[model samples]
Target: MTQIAQQHANMDETLMLEYGKGNDTAFAELYARHKGPMYRYICRQLGSKQHNKAQELFQEVWVRVIDNRNNYTVEAKFTTWLYRIAHNLLIDEHRKNQVRGEHLTLVSDEQDEGILAFHQGKQEGSVHNDFLQQAIKHCVELLMPQQREAFLLRHEAGFDPSQVCEIVGAKPETVKTRLRYAMSQLRDCLQRKVGATEVGGEREI
Candidate 1:
């Protein structure tokens, strides 16, 4: 195999270790591989409308990753370690908002309030691109935080249930349940929004 192919195939943990040992190239490659999804994951957590805020947080995540390179262990999945940082930073923001008496609207499992209300769009039979995006975002925002976190970590970040457990510090069964609930909620919400029984084509999101 070509050297380029080998580099491309390097595991995240390996790249992290290499970066820890001062291999800037490995760190660059790892960032390239992870940046897109990491940004999206943060957006999904923070809200897509919070674009500038999300960008700021995304930069912070990378900065933390760089500064804490020495703290990473080869035993844990690199993505899990990265996610733990992201999650904690978000929690810190939530706490800050609370302290200022400016709490962000949270998804309540009971009341089912959505971030975006597009009731008329649902009856329209077909939702085009922008509408679809809004619908999915609204659906996501309606989910319980734990459920949404698990879903984004699993689907957006490509982490398995075990890795998700490690990142979230939840039990394996709890992680599985969160993922299941998240998928179920998304599927139902999207189906109602777009008049479809499925989501993400045949992939089920």
Candidate 2:
């Protein structure tokens, strides 16, 4: 690795600790690293109409991160900690507004195509890829908020079921069920486009 690049490759927990010790540079580096994906996640969750509110919540999350640095721990991944704060803030916003939006399932398209590739018997990568993209987009819109959030945490954020339960404050079975229901609904929604993916919808999640 290049000398400067190597220097920039600090582990998330290590950077968190460094920032906790009042190193402004460490905090800046950490912020720069996660800012994009974090902002995208917030925007996706809150949607376009609430962009201003999303920006406000984004700042609020960072403020909490900075203020609570002394109490940060390495027991979980830094991104998980960050997402938990965002998720809780979103929940708070929902409670305060007495609304949770329209329960849309729009997610960022920057995720690995794997999030769109759940076909069991159908091809993984083939000519229908373009068609499947639209199908996935339409299908995702069918998911409820909990289902969509669970799906994003697992697929986009790469959190496993247990970590998802922790970050989402849900039970083990509940998290798994949410994932199953999400995939099932998406699969069912686009079955014709998916072309015999062999996914089952009988399971309750």
Number of colliding residue pairs in each model: 0, 0
Residue 129 lDDT, candidate 1, scale 0-100 = 61
TM-score of each: 0.74, 0.68
Model 2 C-alpha lDDT per residue in residues 54-148, reported as the tens digit of each score: 89999999999999999998787787899999999988876766574543345445332344454332343474566576566555544777887
lDDT of each: 0.76, 0.73
Residue-level lDDT of model 1, residues 32-127, one tens digit each, is: 998999998888877645668889999999999899888878665577788898988888876886797853445453333232234333433455
Clashing residue pairs found in predicted model 2 = none
RMSD of each: 6.9, 9.0
Candidate 2: which stretches are off by over 4 Å?
A: 1-10, 99-138, 191-205
Error of 1 at 80 (Å): 1.2
